[model samples]
Target: MMTSSIVQRVSECFIKPLHPIEDSKQISYLTGWDIAMSSMHYIQKGLLFKKPTTSPNNQQDFIESLLKKLKYSLSHALFHFYPLSGRLVTHKTQHPPSYTIFVDCSNNNPGARFIYATADVTISDILSPVDVPPIVESFFDLNKAINHDGHTMPLLSIQVTELVDGVFIGCSLNHCIGDGTSFWNFFNIWSEIFQSQSCENENDVPISRLPFHYRWFLQGYGPPISLPFKHHEEFISRYESPNFRDRFFHFTPESIVKLKAKANKEFNTTKISSFQALSAHVWRCVTRARGLTNDQKTSCKLAINNRLRLEPPLPQEYFGNTVDVVSAEMTVDELLQNNLGWAAWKVNVAVVNHDDKQVRKMLKEWLESPVVYQLGRHFDPQSITVSSSPRFNMYGNEFGMGKAMAVLSGYANKFDGNVSSYQGYEHGSIDLALTLTPNAMRALELDEQFVNIVV
Candidate 1:
């Protein structure tokens, strides 16, 4: 076993402060995705290798050698950023960008078992999956499997099944680190590094001198983005509750297209996208399912990427939190009666137009504002909330074996949290995964339309 001191020393080598920029506004923008950025500093993608039955005794040596290789490779990555951090900080005071791989041979399944490892991949590649397992026969009870500790990196368990000589690996990762795309890219790069190593005994890890420049995002930008007080208050209120449910709902691609087509035809609107239509439909379905009246209030929060919304696109390699949560709230009556087109229009109005300088300014001021600016006094936590991060077309992720079979998002460990995602299937169908409170799903189960295909 590795000593704690050894782990601590390795971690320190990776955590270093950057050269302070002249402008805080730019710093904020650069760090807008700072939470995500900070989390990246603590990234750990573990690969579990199955030890051969005959070679079980060599596992310890393998681990030691592997650790040396990983430490060197990751330490090299940290070194490239040293100049940017003024080299004042050494690895001792900082977090390192290394992950761990454990070799488990304790299981008694001698020849029946296999091997597997997990790593990062590109942002685009991680989100989209080319294959998906058959829908579980009874998904209602699947809730027991989802767990979210809300730690910087939440661990998810995957059910492993045997495939060929090696056992297929089951995996789950926290979304806060990077979207599906970023996750895959990191994995692919790691795989490239791993596959080329002849043995874990290499004295030096190779360094990838990729670009790390980010000054372009702040060329002519000034600061102090102000966001609507009502919007800020609304989010705070909804999220304030100590308890929340995050449920996952799955829908086929054909169902989504059909829903969108119907919305388009019914509303006589051309600009509304599938997301707006589906979100609107879900909002309507759940509202009516819960028996909420038309006059009651509900809202939907869409997580928008701010990378390209600025005057110029943020760097593709810019590793940070570049997401903005945009909310669309309306009286239940308006949401229910409005044609699909109009409902979608509401989302576009709140999210797409985020490029406006005023909006950016307001957002800055709001985020920077202290807790005293919160508007929680006006609302309750029980109000309805919805969010979606689709994974159908995320860029460039491919494990050496092939594309992932499926991807799911917003899984929660609690009883009241609801999270949603749009998954792509090999059959050309889109799947919807909604995570909601058991009661909420139970309510949904009563609907014949929803019940027939829930699993």
Candidate 2:
């Protein structure tokens, strides 16, 4: 078992852009969907890299070198994703009541929070084969800057922690600024710069993909709707309670393939992908562990990337929130009484229903009635929200050291019935980070079907 007292913060400061934004007067307006997401908490993600053995013998010098390279690369990367260095602002006195907000891409707001820290832990402390590590949360900054008071918080914040045998990069980003896809895009680009160790010239950098900041692509068919503050309060209160426990489960390639084969055989259909099959399996196990009534309604919510689902396809580098939740609901008995293929089919259907027309309709509806419709809002003890994509090149994020030892979600422990998946370091395997009530987690641990598949 890993110890709790592991990480310690050495310094914290705001990292401004290395170069000033030339167009200080330019503003990027938030679409109705962005405005609806402004009140949500920042997404906290961490990548842990094992210490490189090639570093000089001196410990302090090695630490300094790592920080310098990281900061330099991050500042240079901000030039391409400029809006991330900006702040969210509102014009409350405007005629339409200014419920809408925009990103101020001015030179004055050209900074992101950076933190330096150390940990008395090792890669083995986190990557235990049979036990979940307690130090997972300690490897990240707990005090993330959520946009609670409008423009009070920065759009992005980063924390770098040095461990006994590894380094951890913790990133906290405002949800209104971008979704997971955009965040990973920025991460991959930053990694490219760090690995290359030269950010001097934009032309020679070889960073081919540039972010598309034009928010007009999300424009819907109707005028923006105004939601009451009470509704926001109610929505936030539902999922923010401090009554959850987070754990990670590993599924090897063999197990995943076996599950997929089983699911396909039961349905006599070969359409279910690995993700759909795994999600269905997890949803069933979680529902069974919760021990809800047979008639209780439970939903599996998945965030679908709308960038490609849109009619004309948004730019691959579009740097803003462009995702919508697609869910499939079934009663507790209906889920438990069925086979894995039954649930997998439902999950597959949910994803297939989110075509171009459905995405457009979702945007139009949100524009017409602007209310916070996050997957979190649909979550309860009986429901699960699955975020993160297994397709992201998380293991490839080599920032001058080497490949990351592990990737973790810093905030998954805070909410119940939440599941995030990442591509495991091992080929064809997946890492599932799950949060649930203490009792429910215990029940899940004792579940034979679930335990058989998990490594």
Candidate 3:
């Protein structure tokens, strides 16, 4: 939806690591986890910042200075997150006619991208809307770019858009390279390095967490896991459903506590986490707003982190995707008739039960017959995928000038029943971006039960 008429692209360049890895260490293999996200579109999201008022210079000077700081800090970030600078390439063999997908991190590989642009929009335009403005998608150019396009496209791209009175630092990262965890890790590091620019000693800001590059693989599986699908089109869903709408809703800390307490009290246990309780509430409210009958079926595909679910737990700093999509299913009556605790318990059981053994079993099964997460393939009108967690540090990213004003995502990989949660601008607050049918959106906006707690 972005065009040159609306957002002007001033300049663009590829950014590489300041200290490159040797060509041998550059070719990072696609782990089973990474491969699972290979065909998925680049994750599109970014932070919004108020324009710096301290700058005494004109707009041109401010733009140049800001770009310099961003490029410098990003270079340091790339030194550690070098995979972001590499490209994904495919190898075709003649004898067997098989193809292999890998990251081309050789010296000849093209680096990541940094684009500087000026927009005629404002922060209010993005933040004040009940529904995110469609023009916000223009903040980044990777609107429809999938990870497979990494062969030709930059695996990672950062687009800095200078708005009338604000700035938007948008990033488009190939999903195959990492998940939301990895993306934020890289982003926070970049901000840290950026903030340290004004310090007396740049070395004072040491890299707090070094990422673990080892990809996850089943113990018995080959290093090169053979995927069941041959071509990208096999599982990619091209049919875009019309009449869908997206809405932004927020839940404050007090509301979160209340939701969790109510859930635990009803269950007569303290096992239900705040996230589970909140998710269950959202699922119930969304289902009811859809005007579905009591007998209609519904499902919630909740994505869980597997960093600590392995036999030998992965480090907190482990990079790449270890997401496990746990599916919770029930009839409309079961979900709506029951209390919030009942629905939450259903989700909690699925999550607490996915321990080491369960994760290993899922990994082994995937290795045996790999199934790539098809683009918009998980179809069920009543099913919603709740992804991106409140645990992700979304609001604390500070770069000296000030903290982020808000968080916004671009139009990529979004479909009906897709929900993404982000930490709000304040602590203990969560913002949910829900995509639903246009009619459902209208109902949800008017649904008193759903609107009462929304901040």
Q: Judging by TM-score against the true structure, name the best candidate.
A: 3
State TM-scores per candidate: 0.55, 0.90, 0.94
For 105-198, candidate 3 gives per-residue lDDT tens digits of 7656668899999888778777877788878888986778777788888989999999888889999999988988998988888887787664
Per model, state how many residue pairs clash: 63, 0, 0
Model 1 Cα lDDT, one tens digit per residue, 157-270: 222222212222233333322333444344444344544454444444453424243322232332222222332222222223233233345666667677678777776767
Query: How would you order the candidates by TM-score, starting with the best?
Result: 3, 2, 1
Task: Count backbone overlaps in model 3.
Answer: 0
Which window of ten consecutive residues has the lowest lDDT sum in model 3? Answer: 196-205
Clashing pairs in 2: none
lDDT of 2 by residue, 150-246 (tens): 3777788888988788888988877778888888898998888888765444443658578887764444332233433332344342235475777
RMSD of 3: 2.4
Question: Per-model C-alpha lDDT, please?
Answer: 0.39, 0.77, 0.82
> Candidate 3: misplaced stretches above 4 Å?
1-5, 54-57, 93-97, 198-205, 228-230, 235-241
How many clashing residue pairs, candidate 1? 63
Q: What is the lDDT for 94 in model 3?
A: 50
Candidate 2 segments whose C-alpha is farther than 4 A from its true place: 1-6, 54-57, 94-96, 129-135, 142-145, 148-150, 198-204, 216-239, 373-377
Q: lDDT of model 3 at residue 24? A: 62
